[model samples]
Target: MYIILFNLLSWVTFFVFLFVLYLLILWMWGNMTAKVPFVGVPSKVLHEIEKALDINDDSVVYDLGCGDGKVLFYLYKKNPKATYIGIENSSFPTILAKTRNWWHKKFNTSKIEIIKKDFFEVDLSNATHIFTYLYPSLMDDLLPKLDKELKSGTKLVSASFHFTTKKEIKEIDLKRGRYQLTNKIYVYEF
Candidate 1:
């Protein structure tokens, strides 16, 4: 009986080790390789976000996570006078955002900036429109900051995850994931 118990404990420990490795892999990939936990904002959602917020050519838009800075880049393509800011915590994403911003500022007709830092550390009060693709867990840390930092009538957009407190201005299904409806954008006003 003791031997059997030992074997069971060993197996449990081994599985826990594997699970931890998996989580580490996810974090590293999200921060470096971006294999998972990093997905671009879908075009459908971007369209709706811009439309819902009534984004103008001169709007100051801030994209949290800003993976590859596609959302901000595309928005700049549409409106050249708009100021785009990207907050990316991961090295790979931040580097990519920097490269993109450099090229666009080099030749393109607009100015875009990328900052390497966690979204929670940045100030969003002056942001006319804010975009994020982060999960609900991040929301737990961000809601209070949002409540305190953002001004009245500022637009907040999230892809796939929902915050518990804010009133969602719109919800639409343009894509479906394996276990959930994906193309969902939640817009909030503060």
Candidate 2:
């Protein structure tokens, strides 16, 4: 009985290890393909984002490349009347975002819609507010799309990277004491 139990435990451990390894590989592949790793907007930056935009019941907010949907969830919590949408291309992060949304729906009256699709393919015309934390090149590529799709008076709040082609109306520098952080939060109006 002891030997059988030990064998069963060993098999369980082996399967668990394999499953973890598979998940790790999937996460790496998703990140590589998406070109952006799963990085959540920091709480401090979220606060800055909150201050940057004016969200209301009529607002439709979109978070492009919203990994794990933390930004959308945070914004939804602050203004439950607004509709929040999270677009993520990576599978792992999309799954995580969906799971988080499901868990969050238990307590909240409104739900954040997390879609596992490329941001470029999704329509931005409906978005009254947009948030992102992407690299410089991606931001440059996204500008044309934003220009074409986003309606006038729409607000965009970008964390870390800003669009080179356009000027931001407001730039908020995040600092810890006297030291300024390399990345800043930029707000632009379309």
Candidate 3:
């Protein structure tokens, strides 16, 4: 019994070590390639995001750099009829998002897609709403792509960072809450 218990404990430790190593590598890769670390939108911010977006049955929402699909999943619950797409470049977060999406599909009839590709590479022509929680510089870099692809009157909601070139139609500041790590959410119309 003691021998079996020791073997189980050793296996657990080895798996734990592998998980940590995987995360470490992913972190480094994200920083080097995307120039942004993987950070999930806080629960408080999700509320603000939902309020910022005007999703409908015909709406096609895209969450750029969607880490673990948390934002898309939350929005999916709110607007089940709307089509949701998550674009994640990092492998670990893509895997996590896909796993969560698989589980979510089992219980609901929502349309959620997790694509493991750079957001820049994907065409944004069909998106009715776009959500991003990326760095300021990256947000600036994304403006040209957004301008080129998104059709007229498309809504772009950005958390924490705003595009310098585009003027935001609405901006919400959430400083009162305890979970308010990123205080501002900007909304723009293309």
Candidate 4:
């Protein structure tokens, strides 16, 4: 009798947890679609960007909607002098970035900062390059902001979706059919 009750309780808890996770996903999507929806950059894509963009020590890259901060981590490893900043609104990912950066700092490594705030509010005049994988709607909203804030030569690298309803010629299409990578990243220079 006791075993039966415990099993039922466990099943109930599991279902409840699933429902909670589902609700959280929707809530997060509503708040920060592609912008901060916890997407770490794909390894192949990251390498491709490094080669194409010629990521140097002087590049100041900001990954908008930087989830668990994998892109920033990759950038830090690639170029030590490159200042990497990630603007993430979610609490969990912000904490993750903070902890990871703290550990790296303790070991005397690259300077990676994760700001737990909305990217739309931050000043982007100093950003040499901006990396993002946000959804189309969010990107659309950010388009005007970028146009106003970012300088003429600033680079914008977008993953998965485009902001405006326009075709990009300088896009990198990788692993289209059988390969795992589904999103085609577009790079634009302003």
Candidate 5:
């Protein structure tokens, strides 16, 4: 029994070490290749946006820089009939998000896609709703592209970063209740 316990402990330690190493490599690669690190939207902020948007079943949702597809999954859970597209540039998070999409495809059987490419390269013309948690500089660059691609009346929800465009319709601020940190989600109609 002691020997079996020792073997199990050794295996657990080895896997933990490997997982840590994998995360370190992903961090290095993300810093080198992508402009921003993989940061997820806080749950409170996500809920606030979901409540505000009241996404319909037929809406097409695009999540730019969708790290691990948390936002997509949340939205999917809320309304499985809606189509979700996650565009992730980084390799590791994209792989994880694809794996998640596969699992969802096998189980929930929804229209969800995870593409490992730059968000800028994808066309947003058909999107009925768009979501992003990008930095201010990237947001500035993306505003023109969104304006040119998305049709009029498309809704956009930006978390933590505000665009300079005059299209903003609503803003909701929520406190995380820790770290004295507060986040804001901006809603815009184009």
Candidate 6:
């Protein structure tokens, strides 16, 4: 009986490690293909973003290149009446976000829609609020597209990057301890 129990424990540990390794590989590959690494915004920063946006009950929020649906789900939890849409190109993050949504539905009735497609391909005309954590180059490419597509009075909240065309309505400073972070939260209006 002792030997059998030990064997079972060993097998369980082995499988757990294997699963972790598989997930790591999947994440790396997805990032490589998407050209942007999956960097989840800190919970503190997310809260600041929520506060800065002042999301309302009727706001339609879209998170372009939303890795793991963190922002969308966070906002949804705060305001369930609002619509939150997440667009993710990478497969691993999309699958992870979808699974999280499925599990989240058990207690919360708010539904967060996750789209597995390139951010460029998704439509932004109907978005009342948009959020992103993209690089400078991507932001440059996206500026004209968003200006052309988004309706007037749309709010854009970007983390770690700024848009070239639109002037920032508000900029929030995110600092921790002695180090003042450079990834300031920028809010823009269209």
lDDT of each: 0.77, 0.88, 0.90, 0.78, 0.86, 0.86
Candidate 6 TM-score, true structure as reference: 0.86
35-99, model 5: which lDDT tens digit per residue? 87887887766678787667898899999999999999998998999999999999788878998
Error of 4 at 152 (Å): 1.2
Show the colliding residue pairs in model 5: 153-190
Candidate 5 Cα misplacement greater than 4 A, ranges:
1-23, 177-182
lDDT of 3 by residue, 40-111 (tens): 988867888998997998999999999899999999888899999999999878888998999888998869
Candidate 5 lDDT score at position 176: 58
Tell me each candidate's TM-score: 0.76, 0.87, 0.88, 0.77, 0.85, 0.86
Question: Between which residue pairs do clashes occur in model 3?
Answer: none
- Give the lowest summed-lDDT range of ten residues in model 1: 30-39
lDDT tens per residue, model 6, 46-101:
78889877889889899998889988888987899998999998878888899998
lDDT tens readout by residue for model 2, 28-78: 998787677887776767778887887888999999999988888888878
Instruction: Give the candidate number with the greatest lDDT.
Output: 3
Distance from true position, residue 51, model 5, in Å? 1.7
- What are the per-residue Cα lDDT tens digits for candidate 4 across 1-190? 9999999999999999997787677557645743435656677778776654556778888988887788888877778888899988876667678888888898866678889888989999888988887778988888888889988878887877776764454787776566565357788877
**Best-to-worst lDDT order:** 3, 2, 6, 5, 4, 1
Worst 10-residue lDDT window, candidate 2: 174-183
True lDDT of residue 114, candidate 1 = 91
**Which 10-residue span in candidate 4 carries the lowest summed lDDT?**
30-39
Q: What is the C-alpha RMSD of each candidate to the true structure, in Å?
A: 11.8, 2.4, 2.4, 5.8, 3.1, 2.5
| Model 6: how far residue 109 lies from native, Å | 1.2
Superposition-based RMSD of candidate 5 using all C-alpha atoms, in angstroms = 3.1
- What is the TM-score (0 to 1) of candidate 3? 0.88
